[model samples]
Target: MLKAMVLRNIKLYFKDKGMFFTSLITPAILLVLYATFLGNVYRDSFTSNLPDGFSLSQKLIDGTVGAQLISSILAVSCVTVPFCSNMLMVQDKITGARKDLTISPVSSAVLSGSYFLGAAVSSLLVCFTALALCLGYVRTIGWFFSGKDILLLSADIVLLVLFGTALSSMVHFFLSTQGQISAVGTLVSAGYGFLCGAYMPISSFGSGLQKVLSFLPSTYMTSLVRNHAMRGALAQMEADGVPKVFVDATRESLDCTVEFAGKTVTIPAMYAYVGGMVLVLLGAYLAVQYLAERKRIYS
Candidate 1:
């Protein structure tokens, strides 16, 4: 029965045309546009600052482009998955289909689990697809993720996908209409790039803005991905004997290791924060479900 429900939701998602495109369009456009326009601007700035006799401009440009694409992927992945995941719940409510199922012998637990699980799985697929597309974009810039890089990227995807699922679940409980979901979805999809540090480095923000964005998964997501994806480029620079000062400056400019409360958050700590957010958000979701169930029985 659980399997049936999950499969049904996945099938329905593909059956809808607009939704299928919405999941891909925002992220894809961001990746292509930013990498094309800003990638060169940053690359030019990056190359110009180096002392004379540095012939690494072309390679550095590729690396900067790769780094930007990684940022684009995170913005795309975080927003794409959650935006696509919640629609199942909204659709069931809007079409009155869940009412019939709720009246049946099925436990609310099973129904809820089915919907969340279905969304989780759907989001996972969407994230992986984004990763694959990002990988292709990364290659276009003359770089590729090594095996270890792929493994790390995969883990990041898993954690971010979980966070996205929990976020969708927790938020959907309050929203009982498709219109509300669409409005929120549109806003998030449109704004997440700015909110999450995808369009600009986190370091560029004012202290107050940084404090607020630091609490969001997108902020951490950007840091984590840029750190990992840019490793190859950084390593290349290191190998080319780029000065320590320049390397450090580049890393800081990209917001690879973010500082919060005067402490640097390493890649491991960022992963922990993301993983913790997943647990916290999912717990809140379960609590909301329990409360809603009790209210339904008593009312």
Candidate 2:
């Protein structure tokens, strides 16, 4: 049943060639543009402001870390994944497909799991393709270590996709119409991404805004990117001519931080941030399911 549902979804997704291209190709294009245009800007920004002693050259050379952060950011905050996921749900709702599923022999768990699985696959493709584009651009412009960082980055991308899928599930539940869903999804996602340090540091915002940003899932998504990419980059910086004070200062200035895999990870505090969201989403799913079942029985 799960297989059938997944296959059906894959077919439907491809049948709409426009949607397929928009979902997969748009992000890759954006990543290429950002890496090509902003890569150097970030490099320059890092170099110019890199307090008095750090090796800006090595940080730039750490293309793996940069690619990871950029790719993950593009995947999580850009609204493409959430937009697509919400659209799928809205389509199902509008056509009465979701209502049909509610009455079908297939369990609710299977129905929800199938949709989440399809979204996960779609998101994974976007993230991988975006990273590849970023990596190619990174090679052209900077010094990036492509070995361990690549593996770590790939793991980070997978986690971000999972986090995105879980998040979209809750969004899918609340929206009553496609237009409303799309508008809210885009605005909320883009706003959170920007405010969560995906494109810039959340700390750059006023303190109140930063505190609110801390609750957002994207904050942790950025944290995962930082831990995966910038952790090594920072370690390398410390080894190079960067002063301890400057390195410490840079770490302190980070928007979020985490400790994972027996290492003290400093990026954005992505784990705690996403964990909170996941818990909330799980609770929402349960409440919706209970209400749905109760309505079905009582009515």
Candidate 3:
């Protein structure tokens, strides 16, 4: 029964062609912006502070900036894509489908699980496709990632997807109308990237703003992806005779190493923060479900 419900939700999500493609609009827009002029902006930043007569290869610079662009897309997509994918719950409520399910043999717990699992799976599919396309683009510019880096990146995507789905599920439970969901989705797509440091480096913000962003799980998740994506390019810069100080500075500036309250956050700490948030959000969703079930029983 659980499996069937999960499958049905997935089918419905994909069957709507408009919704399926709309989930990808955020990433698509970022890609177009990069190709048009964002690419040059990143390239100039890479070379802006070089010592006189010190030069890096164009291929290396392109590869580095390309990695940063893809990482930002991945981070933002984890949230925005899930926001679209999880709308099935809101649709079910608005269309009376959820009430229909309540009369069936399927338990409310299983129904809720189906929506959660369906959203996670659907979002994962779209995010993986985006990752593949971004990697292919990076290869054309200059491929630097090793086998291990790819494996780590895949793992990062899974973690972020789970986090995204849980967060979206909690929010969707309160959204009873299509208008509410659409408005919230638009707001998230517009603001989440900046809040998470995907559109601009957190280090560029004022100290107070940086400290506030540090408390967000999305911020750490973005840093994790950026760290893996840019690892190879940063190493290649050192091998190409760039000074160690310059390489370290680049890493910090790009947010591959994030700071919180005057302390550098390690990679393990980033993973721990995201993982903890996922667990907390899932627990909160279950609590809400239980409370809603009790209300239904007493009413």
Candidate 4:
């Protein structure tokens, strides 16, 4: 029954062509923007601080920029895409479908799990497609990633998708109307990239702003993706004789490692932080679901 419900929700999400494509709008816009001029901007930022008489390969710079672009798109899409995918729950509510489903013998837990699992699966489908395209683009520019990099990135995307799904479920539970979801989606799509240091590095901000952004789990998520995506490029830079100091500085400036309270956050710490937030958010959603169900029964 749970599997059927999950499949049904997935079908509903894809069957709505507008909603399906709309989920990709933010990533699409970022891709276009990056291709047009943002690519050069990032490249320039990366090379602007080179020491006197030092030069790096244009190929290396392009590869690094491509890697950063991949990280940015993945980070932003992890949240925005799931926001659209999870609209299934809102659609159910607005159409009276959820009430009808509840009247069936299916347990509320199974029905709710269907929504979460369906959204997570749908988000994974979209994000994985984006990852493939990004990898292809990087290859055309200058491929630096190893097979292991690809594997780790795939794992990171799965973790991020789960986090995004739980977050969307929690947020959408309170939204009973299309307008509410639309408004919130717009707000997130427009601002989430900046907040999470996807469009810009947190290090570029003032110390106060950087400190504030550090508290956001999405910031760490972005760092995790950036670290893996750029690992090969950074390694290549080191192999090509770039000074260690410069490479470390680049890592910090590009948010390959996030800093909290003047301390660098290690990769494992990032995973722990994001994973903890996922559990917290999912638990919160389940608690809310229980409360809502109880109220419905008593009222």
Candidate 5:
């Protein structure tokens, strides 16, 4: 029964053409823009910013383009995964399916697990697909993740997906209508990239704005992935005679690192940030779920 419930939601997500396509639209558009135009723009930025005699290498091309790809993926995944997950729950609420499920032999725990599992699986599915396609495009431009990098990226993605699922559970508790869901989807898809600094580098913003964006979990997530994604380029730049100071400048200018309370956040700190956010979100989601279950049982 648990397996069936999980499969049902996953199936519904795909079967509903509107939901399926809507979830992917922003990612597809962003991937195209990044792969085609932004990659060239970043490459040009490198050429223009560095010393006159600096020579380019494969890793330089990889770093400039790879940073954008990593940030873009993290931004889209953070929003889309949770949004799609909650949409499924909201659909169940509106259609009375959840009420039916509540009355079945399945316990509240199983039902909740199913919904989460369905969302995580589906969200991961779409994200993985997007990742593969984007990586394929970047590979042609001389940027590719090494095997070790892929494993690290995969772990980061799974954590983000889980965090997204937990967040969706909390949000879905409030979303009782399709209109509300649609409004959220439209707004997030249109604005999250900019908000998350995927469309633009946070480093370019004023210090005040940078501080504000740092509070967002997306900021840390992007920073974490961008470091792993662009580290090779840094090495390449160093090898090619670009000073470490200049490479650090490139990272700073690109929003690949963030500052908090006058200190630069490190990789370990970024991981801590993500981990802390997940715990807080999961706790809130559980509290809301318990309250909702209580109300449903009595009402």
Candidate 6:
């Protein structure tokens, strides 16, 4: 049943030529464009902007840059999935497909899971391809690496996909029209991208802004990826000019440890956020089902 749902989504997605290109081919092309032409220019420009005395390793800075590019690119793809999925949902709702799907032997869980799985698979491929391009660029720049880093990077890509899936699932039910979904999802994704520190350090953001961003799932998701990619390099920096205390604090913060920088901070609860989002979306699905059932009875 899951396989059937997955295949159906894949087929439907590909059936639209414009969406197919936007979701898959567009990111790949943008990555190539950035790496081949724009990346060096952007890096040099950004590096020049940094003031002296605030030190960062080349690897960490580059990792952040790469992450920005990947996250920016993925943000577009993220909206694309929900935009398409919600459009499909809206169409189904109008055409009685929602009622039909609700009444089918497939449970709401299975149906929702299947849609999420399909989105997850597509998101994973796009993110992994983006990561590969970033890593290849890193290798070309002569950054250190191990087999373990590659494995961890792949795992983070998978986690990012799950994060995106959760985000899209949460947003899908809130809007009925494709245009509304696309507009709102794009806004939300952009907000998440900023809040997650995808383009800038959350630490640098004002305290109020950071506090607000703390509730966002992407903040945790992006930090998870950035930390994993930079962990070894950050560890090595401690032996160099960076203070051991600073490195320890950074490591502790990234590892989700509470004690950092002479303060006991409670770790942000990403799992709870994901669980709450799942329940909210499930409730929404049930609400829509109930409405459809009542309409049928009344009609």
RMSD to true structure for each model, in Å: 1.8, 4.1, 1.0, 1.0, 2.1, 5.0
What's the lDDT for candidate 5? 0.75
lDDT of 3: 0.90
Pairs clashing within candidate 2: 61-143, 61-144, 63-144, 220-270, 223-268, 256-268, 256-269, 257-269
Evaluate all candidate structures by whole-model CA lDDT and list the values in order. Answer: 0.76, 0.63, 0.90, 0.90, 0.75, 0.58
Candidate 4 structure quality by residue, lDDT tens digits, 1-299: 99999999999999999879987665777777886778988888778888778898888989998999989999889888999999999999999999999889988888888999999999999999888878988999989999999999998999999999999999999999989988999898888889999888898899888888889998999998999999999999999999999999999898997878888889999999999999999989988998888888899
Per-residue alpha-carbon lDDT of candidate 1 for residues 1-299, written as tens digits (9 for 90 to 100): 88888788888877786766677665677677767787777777777777688767575668666766665566557655666766878788888888887788877777777777777777777777777877887777667457887787777777777787888888887887867988878777777677777777878899998888777777888777777787778877877898878888888877787888888888888888888888998888888887887788799
**TM-score of each candidate?**
0.93, 0.81, 0.98, 0.98, 0.91, 0.70
Report how far off residue 237 is in candidate 2 (Å). Answer: 2.6
Query: In terms of TM-score, which candidate is stronger, 2 or 5?
Result: 5
Better of 1 and 2 by TM-score: 1
Model 2 TM-score is 0.81
Colliding residue pairs in candidate 1? none
lDDT of 6 by residue, 19-89 (tens): 55555665577667656665676567556654566566776656545544554454444434444433444
User: Tens digits of per-residue lDDT for model 5 on 1-299?
Assistant: 88998999899998987777766665677777776777777767767787667667765565566656755766566557568755888898899988888888987777777877888888888877777776676676666457777677677778778777877777777888989898877776677777777777788787889889888988877776677667666666777788888888888877666888878888888888888998898778767777778888899
1-299: candidate 3 lDDT, tens digit per residue: 99999999999999988789998666777776875677888888878977779998888988999999999889899888988999999999999999999888989899999999999999999999888888988999988999988888988999999999999999999999878998999899899989989889897998888888889998899999999999999999999999999999988888898888788989999999999999999889988988898899789
Model 2 residue 2 lDDT score: 91
- What global local distance difference test value does model 1 have? 0.76
lDDT of 2 by residue, 232-288 (tens): 566767777678777665654554343344345444445555656666775676578
Q: Model 2 off-target regions past 4 Å?
A: 51-72, 75-80, 254-273
- What's the lDDT for residue 274 in model 4? 95
**2 or 4, greater by lDDT:** 4
